[model samples]
Target: MPYSRLKNLWGGTKSLGKLKVIILSHSQQLVEVDELSEACGLEKIDLQGCSSLKSIPHTDQLKNLQLLNLSGCTRIKRTEVEKKIKGLDQEGGLKETKSESMMFSTLAVKLEPGDNTETY
Candidate 1:
């Protein structure tokens, strides 16, 4: 098993306050997953190839999140995450983030070109 990117990253420090990106591809573990929400400046998160990872914590607090990669998290059910994402979108949570511009293009959900956002 490979080293955990997260554990290795914060090993030298007790806290990571402004973490922006975390790429944990193929890491042995993705523990403390909920800690992501604590980082206020979190942007892109890459969990590609983390086959051991099953479910991901809802990250509505990570309003700055731009990209998310769960391609290799075979255990993760997209339907579950879609529901959470939908909830966040409805509350104008994710839409306020900078990555909102890429949400429609990247995710299955689509925001019409001229449609009123309030009703979307």
Candidate 2:
């Protein structure tokens, strides 16, 4: 859902055992997904433009997650994203291919025109 009014995603999500993708792009007020960790089978979570988001559930418990698109999330630091990816890499949770690494690198370093803030 884009441009949604949600501030958080909590109750009732734990029962989505077969859920694979969640597209909450541009939900500007969204700050958290409290039950995200319970969605073990999720593969993609696209929170692309959620500018007010502060944090997400830790990636360590997301064994089946393949993509987490946090692009344009101005409240999240690039360093934090880098650290999470690094930890996932160390634990073999993400593919170690050059192209995949490059993609994350690009996402982490990308900056908006005239925007020098260090956030992704």
Clashes of each: 0, 0
Candidate 1: tens digits of C-alpha lDDT, residues 1-120: 234654333443335467788767677466435555567566666766665665565555656665666554555554445543422332322222242221211232222322322333
Off by over 4 Å in 1: 1-15, 86-120
Model 2 spans with C-alpha error above 4 angstroms: 82-120
Task: Give, for candidate 1, the lowest lDDT window spanning 10 residues.
Answer: 99-108
Which candidate should be chosen as best, given TM-score against the real structure? 2
Prediction RMSDs, each to the true structure: 9.6, 11.0
Q: Estimate each model's TM-score.
A: 0.56, 0.65
Candidate 2 shows a clash count of 0
The numbered model that scores best in lDDT is: 2
User: Each candidate: what lDDT?
Assistant: 0.49, 0.60
